[model samples]
Target: GAGVSQTPSNKVTEKGKYVELRCDPISGHTALYWYRQSLGQGPEFLIYFQGTGAADDSGLPNDRFFAVRPEGSVSTLKIQRTERGDSAVYLCASSRGGFGHEQFFGPGTRLTVL
Candidate 1:
């Protein structure tokens, strides 16, 4: 199967609006991750899901940010009450869910909150 993929590629929204970013991981990958990268900054981990359950979510900045991998392959990142500071590149990655396995990253979704 192909590598991870994200939808829309880019998004523009006004403050206080809501948005949903989608990610499609490679087939058979059990570990999926979400990250956010600000301008000139490294990507920050937001959440990790193993199969259909979230294995780690402590990196989520607040309750307004959430993610779900309902079917264990496709995931969605949801944002509520968007803010200008929320503008960033939302990246998705996937791995084999094994220790020492390398994670493959998607092209990312550039979100601009105006």
Candidate 2:
């Protein structure tokens, strides 16, 4: 009964470098979400996956950012040609697989692009 987990609690990379952030949701949770949080802003929703496919990804900043949940459990956020502005805390959360369900959040991955 482990909660959500994110790898590489912290990451530092040069600008324009590609990086991947991983997330493992709680067991049996079918709903997963990705969010980004800046210094003063609240966590901004990035994408949501229901099962093995992305159900909503309207918040993705651009094509440079992408995410996948191939088996409906673990997910990876891929950032390509990263920019300094991409620095932020990337959070992952999961729920019982529906709207209004309480979501469990991970500690998040702090990404710093120099």
Candidate 3:
């Protein structure tokens, strides 16, 4: 792959609903990240995966949010009990190195909780 790619570019759901956002990273990239961007704000780191384990998940607001990279290439962000405040663009990125390295971002998945 050329870069990160996100699926279901847009999503609409009722409050309390659950959603899953997917990310496909470039081949051979071992560092992956997930971020959430609210209106008028920059992307906020949500989680980071180094290989198949989550290296940092402190950015996740609460237990309602989680992500996984099982094969170290593709990842999925899972949100539970979605709230209206959760409406935002979910972005995925990948780099060849760990933190501090340049990241290639994917076109985000816009999620709306109505």
Candidate 4:
């Protein structure tokens, strides 16, 4: 894709279910990130991948959330045992360099847990 694109624009799942959100970053972007946004708040970083390896994932809330960028261009965020509190918008962004670079964000995938 030319710009960042995320699949399954909206997802509604029951509590304890598993969900996978996909993000396709712009080609040749060296940095990819996954963030979650709750109501009335800014996006919170979940993971940051420099190329194919995760450089920093300190912001992830718990073991239930994981993100991977195996081939570097595309990434997926997997959430296990989803809860009602986990309902939020999962956002994906890409940048050109390691850190402090301008990022292009995709339209987030809205996850709703019931």
Candidate 5:
């Protein structure tokens, strides 16, 4: 029963670079979600996956961001052409399935675009 986990606890990159953040959800979790949190702001949903398919990716800011969950468990968030504006805490969470259940969150990967 591993809890959600995110890598790099902190990341520093230049204005135009690429980064891939990884997430490992709890075992048996069928739902995974990615969210970004700006300083002092609440988490903004980026993408959500149910089983192996991405159920909702509407919250993705732009083409620079993408995610995948092929095995219905672990997931990765990739950001292309990183920018200072893209700097934020990338949070990963998982639940039983739907919205009603509580989501367990990781410590988050803090992305800093210099």
Candidate 6:
């Protein structure tokens, strides 16, 4: 892809259901990140991957959330037992490498748990 692309720009679901969102980063980029933004709040970092390894998964809220970048390219975020509290914008970003790099963000996947 020419830029970061996120799937399902908007989603509405009942509590306890599962959802999966996808992201395709710019070609040749080696770093990917996931963040959650609630209304009026800044984006909160959830996870980051470098190549095929997750360099940081410390920010994942719980076991119900997981992400994978198997080929160091496209990635998917899976949420289980969704709750009302999970309603927010799921943002995906990618950078050349390292924390200091400028991250390019997608339009984001907005999940609404009703």
C-alpha lDDT score of every prediction, in listed order? 0.95, 0.97, 0.94, 0.94, 0.94, 0.95
lDDT of 3 at 100: 82
Which candidate leads in TM-score? 2
Candidate 3 total steric clashes? 0
lDDT for each residue of candidate 1 in 1-114, tens digit (9 for 90 to 100):
599999879999999999999999989999999999999999999999999999999999999999998889999999999999999999999999777688999999999999
Backbone clash count for every predicted candidate, in the order shown: 0, 0, 0, 0, 0, 0
Top-lDDT candidate index: 2
Per residue, candidate 2 scores C-alpha lDDT tens digits across 1-114 of: 799999989999999899999999999999999999999999999999999999999999999999999999999999999999999999999999768999999999999999
Give the TM-scores of the predictions, in the order they appear: 0.98, 0.98, 0.96, 0.96, 0.96, 0.96
lDDT of 4 by residue, 31-81 (tens): 999998999999999999999999999999999988888898899999999
Candidate 4 residues lying further than 4 Å off, grouped into runs, are none
Q: What is the lDDT of candidate 1?
A: 0.95
Candidate 3 lDDT tens digits, 1-99: 487899989999999999999999888889999999999999999999999999999999999998999989999999999999999999999999655
Worst-scoring 10-residue span by lDDT in model 3 = 94-103
Residue 106 accuracy (lDDT) in model 3: 97
What is the Å distance of residue 11 in model 4 from its true position? 0.5
TM-score pick, better of 2 and 4: 2
Model 1 TM-score (2 dp)? 0.98
As a whole number from 0 to 100, the lDDT of residue 89 in candidate 5 is 98
Worst 10-residue lDDT window, candidate 1: 94-103
* lDDT, residue 39, candidate 2: 99
Candidate 5 lDDT, 1-114, residue by residue in tens = 678999979999998999999999999889999999999999999999999999999999999999999889889999999999999999999999866888999999999999
Q: After superposition, which runs of candidate 1 have C-alpha atoms over 4 Å from their true positions? A: none
lDDT string, candidate 6, 1-114, tens digits: 488999999999999999999999988889999999999999999999999889999999999999999988999999999999999999999999756999999999999999
